[model samples]
Target: MPSKLTTVLAVGGVAVITSNPGSGMHALVQEHQMGILIEAENQQALNDGIAAAMSQDTTQFSQNARRYAEQHLSLEGVMRGYEQLLLTC
Candidate 1:
């Protein structure tokens, strides 16, 4: 479960600049509709992506992030996903 700090501190949605492109965490972040992705290999692209992400610090993003967390990242959300996975197995 995400702590209060995680919820309160995260105002800029989510993003990661990494060389490992399509890892599990990246996929999960994308799947949950959290934030943008920037490739670590390209400085110019990363900078532009960061600028874009920074510019999108709006109420809509917050609302969407909160909704996504509630639907897929919260304790209940995690438990629900886990339960569904268990049933399939």
Candidate 2:
């Protein structure tokens, strides 16, 4: 995820994450704790995806999202992961 999305998730905001097919979104969906994925190939599809995300459930994931982001997705966590990978050497 980009910094913008990272900030949103870090602040307990549900994101409507969208990207073109094979261009993005899946890694984020798989890794992030909170957000909806919108995979679109065209303009109309992208619009629909945004609408769908806007209308979906936020209450279900808002509380845990920030904590999850900090513990698993934050810069500190990334540094830890990098350190751990180096330790395998």
**Highest TM-score, which number?**
2
lDDT of 2: 0.70
Q: Candidate 2 residues 1-32, lDDT tens each?
A: 58897788788887766664465466645454
Provide TM-scores for the models.
0.55, 0.64
Worst 10 residues of 1 by lDDT: 1-10
For all the candidates, what are their Cα RMSDs to the real structure? Answer: 4.2, 2.9
Given candidate 1, what's the lDDT at residue 17? Answer: 36
Instruction: Output candidate 1 Cα RMSD.
Output: 4.2
User: Which numbered prediction scores highest in lDDT against the true structure?
Assistant: 2
* lDDT minimum window of 10 residues, candidate 2: 24-33
